[model samples]
Target: MSAPGLLRTERARLTALYGSLLLLAGGGLVALVYVLVGQGLYASVSGVVRTVSPAYRLPVPGETVDVGRSPEPARTMAPGETPTPEELKGYAFTQDLSDAVTDATRHRLLMYSLLALAVFAVLSIWLAWWMAGRVLRPVGVITETARRLSGENLHQRISLDAPPGELKELADTFDAMLGRMEHLVSAQRRFAANAAHELRTPLAVQRAAAEIGLAGEPSPQKVARIRERLIGVADSSEHLVESLLLLAVSQEGLEPGSTGPVDLAALAAAELAADPPHALTVVRTLAPLTVTGDRALLGHLVRNLLTNAVRHNRAGGRIVVETSSDGELAVSNTGPVIGPADVPRLLEPFRRRAERQHTAGEGAGLGLSIVAAIARAHGASLAAEANAEPEGGLTVRVRFPLPDGQGAVRGAPGSKIG
Candidate 1:
């Protein structure tokens, strides 16, 4: 009932069907034998002729009696008359010849009957094979259909119309499974469409308000208020736009090619050199960890984490950046302590728990969401917890699992691994 019982190949199934026909064909020969014995084939012809002769007139020595349904001849003993052998010969109508021919006929009839049986055996075998092939033809079609289905093409169906009652049922079941998968794919596409639309509406309104404020000058206090609010809106919109784009791209997949082992100490020094001269001092403790991913993307991951640390730190307070590897990679930072309840939800989109409110930036709440998504896209894990120091500060860490034999880590096995 399941599209020909896991018939992995066409030849195997054809062989099975042919074998069944061979098994049933023997019965056809048995039916032919029954007809041969039913047509009075057991009686001997000579015995039959002897029994009939006595019922008719019998001849005495040298005398003949007419066996016709006429008057008998006059008494022959008075005249001592003897019948001529010509009359006796005339009375014998192929009697001995009939006996001889019956024996030969019996042998000839038996030989012909056996020859007929042989012909029927051959005919039945050929017919059986032909019939069996006809019965399994639909099953062969279903096998080909299954072979062609794949992720690239999920919209395929089987058409069933044939004997072998179970196979038809199997095809119906396959069609049902495909239907459910198609429905799920459709729902995902719709959800993505709706989310993009909802995010765009607010971004458009915020940009309009900023443009209106910029049209005319106002008092110093009013001007500062407008400027600050516009900057805040601009920042929020930028964060949202970037988050949505990253989420979309990550869902599609990112190629993990063209990444080489990066020197963590060199990278940290470069970041420090590039930073603006803010009160937040850059502190780095780096190790020689050889981790690999998309060079551009991994660099972005490091830059974003460092920026978050610096932005959230108290003025003149230190922002620590560290990198090392344990069979792979670990990057960490320290800042104001993040509460336990907010740690897990921080990475989710648009989620900043109550403890994280009143922060410096009017963030669209996507900083850690980007980090998490990027980590997921690569084969890594990004985690957040309270810093080690009792004078509390938050520490964000990202861990990457080592590849086989410590080659560069990548997206998937044998795929683009940087």
Candidate 2:
């Protein structure tokens, strides 16, 4: 059979293994004890028997007694007659009789010991099998629950009732993993629904613009307006498609040999200089921090952060871009007040505030989500929180692991401008 089949069939292998070990130990102990007790008891009993009868006496160990070789038969003691020492010496224990008793007693002892050991071994094996089953009961539950689960039934959990140990911990961890999978699956469903709606809206708009504007030899003015509208719709669709593809790539993870030392401070500074928000006051605290990751993705991360801040900000508001020597980057902007609870939803694809749902000229709602995906791909942590109300905005932070053999570097002085 295959290895997995062998393992399944021998689920009680631990029981048999331990039982065999105990049996071997018990056998060794039985042999040692039998030898000691048998030798000592036989010697003492034979000595006593020799004393009981004056006609016989204990002989030296291993000596053979030959009755036919005796000079004469044993003689009985007469009343009121004293036996000579020579007579007593002649009746000294015979080897044949001693050997006979020794063999019989040894055989009986061996027989009893073996029988008892056999019975104990059988009991031990049964007990071991029971204990093993009890110990592995949680595993059985986990397996059954897993077999019953799929993408459709991810709600099921293995609530194992085993004692607190490795098995219980494993079950709990498995349940936690299922919970995460369920959450991700639900989010994916929502994302698909939202993506379909978003993609469909522009197509519907373009179709209407074409059907109405191109009918019956339209005027140049109507043609230009319709053509412009079509181009804008097409551009929006292209942007949405591009964003989706980038998100996929980021989540798919950085390719091998695509990672190298990247100066995060320099990258952020370049993004800020490239597209300085005209209406917002920009402040920069660029530090010299080096990290390892895909530089293109890193650039996209910085650009998205800046664009998110600019798009979702009040006119003439402040935008603070900061980088630290400790491989950290943070961006904060002044915008509409956001609740603490709603801040986490911003990292999800196509998630937007109700107020922004009707806002125009705002790019597809994937900037922060793409940032999150890229951060995850680089093994960096990203967190966003609502700034205190009154002067409301959001602060998003990303922490990256430093490149190998690199140490913290001092940050440059803060610079403020638009």
Candidate 3:
């Protein structure tokens, strides 16, 4: 089954379609009445004239039928039954009967034409409504498009969906216009994102070198000096480049073509085991659950959730990772409670809390934005909140739908990857 079409504007077409249907139905009904009653009247009158009325076969002496014209039998019976020539001769007949029938037929025909015209008159009213509807259909479409349209959609056109006659073609044209608009907008977004990312690498290297140079003898006095000088350059550079790169990646968007079955729990555990040990206590119920998605993207999504959790945590707080097959995975960490006001903006790039002042790292506030991008790419859902534990702090969660169609999250595949 296919999904129903989206109507950019449809009221006009609907009105026209209804009007036309009504016209067609009414015209048909009138025509039907004419056919039925006219045939009945003709049959009844013909039968009465033929059966009850007497037709004169004799003429007054010396008088001839057909009004002095030679008498002719318009119709005769079978050979043995036909009146003889002598019998018809000198017979006077009333020519008025045939004339009467002719006159009657004419009157009835006139009446039929008039009644039919009346029916057509009513039909005309409906026809006017129908025509008006058709003419206005395009206008209605244009109006609806205008209502929903914005400057961003300037290139979008309007057309009918399933329109009769030229309307279908019109609709196709409209869709084509919108296709162009989408293409242009997407291209612009992609260009900006790419340009920003390209500028980030050099800035990053410079910042890192600056940090290493000022680190060895750093103290309140020395650190204050470095921070006031080289740190400023690194911070500003990192902030600018990161913000730009984030914007670029978001615009380029995630391509989900890499979807395949990947074991998320295994990935999460492996990530936890890498390099620098976690400073905060970590707890997890590892599952062998698998899901279909881009592995690299999902890995990044998970890392962002972890990084956010880590960055926001109070000293020595605990982080918990939970996995399940209700098509969900969640990670929660203890950190400073984020105020409700800041929660909504957390996922947007370059949107940091106003009270925040961490000069140690090059976080251009793109972490959550990347998380959001990765989530969107893989049809996953992610959320963040303060842990509800009485000694609460921040908690972030990333969820992935389970593979094999809604089964429980698997655990202990029994074999270990070396």
Best by TM-score: 2
Decide which is better by TM-score, 1 or 3: 3
Q: How much lDDT does candidate 3 score?
A: 0.60
List of clashing residue pairs for candidate 1? none
Which pairs of residues clash in candidate 3, taking residues 3 or more apart in a chain or in different chains?
A: 58-92, 59-91, 59-92, 193-248, 288-410, 313-335, 335-394
* Clash statistics: count for each candidate: 0, 1, 7
Ranking by TM-score: 2, 3, 1
Compare candidates 1 and 3 on lDDT and give the better one: 3
Among all candidates shown, the one with the greatest lDDT: 2
Q: Cα lDDT for residue 389, model 2? A: 69
lDDT of 1 by residue, 66-140 (tens): 444435553333245554464455346436545476667767766776677567567755765566566666667
lDDT of each: 0.58, 0.80, 0.60
Can you tell me which runs of candidate 3 are displaced by over 4 Å?
Answer: 1-99, 106-108, 111-127, 130-232, 235-261, 275-279, 325-327, 339-342, 355-358, 405-418
Worst 10 residues of 3 by lDDT: 409-418
lDDT of 3 by residue, 137-237 (tens): 67677569868877576666664655466666676766787777787676557545744653564466557656774667656776666556655666667
What's the lDDT for residue 315 in model 3? 78
Candidate 2 lDDT, 101-142, residue by residue in tens:
788888888999999899989988997778788777888899
Q: TM-score each candidate.
A: 0.44, 0.83, 0.56
Model 1 alpha-carbon drift over 4 Å, by segment:
1-232, 256-258, 276-283, 314-318, 325-341, 355-360, 386-393, 401-418
